[model samples]
Target: MSQNLGLRLCLVVLLCLSGCNAFNGGSTETASITPAGVPTDDPNATRGLAPGLTNHGVVDSIALGDAHEAVLSNTSFTIHGKTTVKYSNGTLRRQGERTARVVNPRDRRYINVSIYTQNKIRSDQKSTNNSFWSNGERVLVALSSSQTNSTTYQHFESRDPQYPILKYHPQKERYYTLFQAVDTKVINHTTNNGTTLYRLTSTEIADSAQLIEYSMNVKIAQNPRNLTFHAVIDSRGVVHEYRLAYTATLTETNPSTSVRVVSTTRYTKMGSTTVDRPSWYAKANNTTPEPPTTYS
Candidate 1:
């Protein structure tokens, strides 16, 4: 394949894998869960639990830890990361930091982050939603605006203009909507060493309820396949804790060989929590109980 075509194909695959919808904004919302063989809640009790843990029948909250660890063939990549999540007051606060090393590509590395609150930005920008800068250079700008007469939040941004903008709609289940995209199909699914494997693909964007949404292409051919099931958690219903099993796939183009590559990233018990923040404004105020670390 020509270098240009190869680049296009690589971009498409990346889009499908990550669901990179840069233009759409999103907010944390509640999701219902029904795991089988679990005990139903007892209405008489003031508290409840998710069946596997403690006997606190009047349970008001629960917590859990999750990790994504994987190994892959056909590519050389190493991912190291951890995430912390707390749920309460009908909201979820998640913070995480990840760093990856590419042995092939260009011998370069970058840090990726996702913090639940707007605390990641400046105070002024926090309210209206603003850009994230490094050393006075605006690397990313996020706008938190709403669609007319709708409960949904629309986030549109050029986090890195060199890459396309992203849009995320939490209310719609359209995890990511990528515009002007491209694709490459390599391994169906495979793992190496002790890591777990997960793969994702994207179909053309579909219009749902008059809103545009993209369907995610996901594959799990490893021991912890359950870990990759795009879980939407509603802690209020489950009782004491919220548990997450997340598995993500990443592919990088070999600048020299231009080979399309993949990896199986892995981990266990990456995050858990017993606290929650009501709103971004409240979190900003620092009125809530002190989390081990204060971002804003």
Candidate 2:
């Protein structure tokens, strides 16, 4: 696993553990939308909402491990955006951020993304990076797989933003997925670009099944517990952003260990984003397109 416990601890736990803690001021109240709407570079944009979001008409509802996906299917969703994660375990800590750009919101291929991670242990920070992008027509992967120690990158015909990358085998947080942990205190706020957005926040509770989806097909991690979360979702059901914070029990260590994690995902620069070829892509794409790899 990578030195940073955020990706390592959360993903390493896999099917092992769950939960986190945060401020719990969520109410089912619906906040009125302020008319800060002006079209951006994203053609699908309308304030914080995308196209195709439907209302369930259920307010003040806290659906823990229930009906969260009902909101996802109807969402036009953000295929181009950024995601960030942070983790800590006593003296050990980690922080990382990911930027992604998918060519089509309807397709998972021909994407551009980069992940930068750092670990803080023993008063020192060590960093590593991973990426998936195109050179010409073929795609290249700079992932350090769990089953291999090879230093060279892998080449693919196409890229999946969710495909596991980096040594810790962490997947890119897809815009289509949402954790059911948020209870939500609804409100509307404007972005720096003058785009109005909706927000919902609350403390998190352990849900191992949800955490498992975060882990890749690598070594098992600890069970997450007492997690806290918040999300930016509009009345139309578009999810603009979310943050998850929690700790999990690590049994691999003698005295069961607890690792703290904070994961934040948001959508920005939607339709305007593009995936440009990285300097290393040409070198990594030297061979024929290999079979596509399975993701978490």
Candidate 3:
């Protein structure tokens, strides 16, 4: 039970984009708009907002746990563009392309798009299995479960003779460790429907940074205390780029929670990046083909 609770907590934290702390400043003030005039990018645009907020180069700070209380320290990555990697042979590689589906609740219309990538290698090696949906169902499955050279690269790293990958026992549920306890902060800003969203600003505080467990099935760390998420969402609440961070402690049971999951969950992205409906969403489905359902 404790393990389950811890896992759930970690899942929630990992799903938090712009940090859970920055979701402060809330008012139940609801606004309505005609379906014909609703902005395609902003799902909540009618809540009294304009357009042109998501122009290029917007910066937002996010906070979690304490609702923007104190400033965080020792931030590591000054996230600029996508993380780049170069092979030993000098061949540069990057993550796959990004795409989005614009949801217009008022008009009952949606637009599916694949934001093209600049790198030929990156684009060529990208996964085309996209799954766009109106709700949680699989609207479009464009890519197959094919592995690439990069995928094989990580697999080789795990099993390499020099740095043998951690072993995992299926029946017993065991595996080797992949990461140590670490801490870092992420900063991003984007405009949606003409609203300037400020994340982890000066007022927000970084409560605590601790190590937790990681998972592959859920692609999230099992940190009940602190989990980090970075989401580049479209106007209609569709995520374009989603990044997560957390720590993994090396212990039998967390002294704080006394739960066990073999090895700790680290700060790494799990699961395959296919085009499917938003994985972390329920009601706000982006499934293709059928129109998405929502509570008006």
**Top-TM-score candidate index:** 2
Task: Give all candidates' CA lDDT scores.
Answer: 0.23, 0.41, 0.23
TM-scores vs. true structure, each candidate: 0.22, 0.52, 0.23
TM-score of 1: 0.22
Off by over 4 Å in 3: 1-98, 106-128, 133-140, 147-196, 201-243, 249-296
Residue 115 local lDDT, model 3: 18
Ranking by lDDT: 2, 3, 1
Candidate 3 local lDDT, 160-194, one digit each (tens):
11110111101011111111122322133345367
Runs of candidate 2 with Cα error greater than 4 angstroms are 1-90, 93-96, 105-128, 134-137, 143-151, 158-179, 187-196, 204-227, 291-296
Candidate 2 versus the native: TM-score? 0.52
> What tens-digit string does per-residue lDDT give for candidate 2 at 1-296?
13323434443332111111111113222233453433334454332232222121113233321233344332323232233233352453333444445443323323333333343244445444445564334557664423244345667676342243322111212222234333334433455345445544555443464553452111434566676666655433445555666566655446765666555544444455555566766678786666654544
Per-residue lDDT value at 217 in model 1: 31
Scored by lDDT, the top model is 2
Order the candidates by TM-score, highest first: 2, 3, 1
Task: Single out the weakest 10-residue window by summed lDDT for candidate 2.
Answer: 15-24
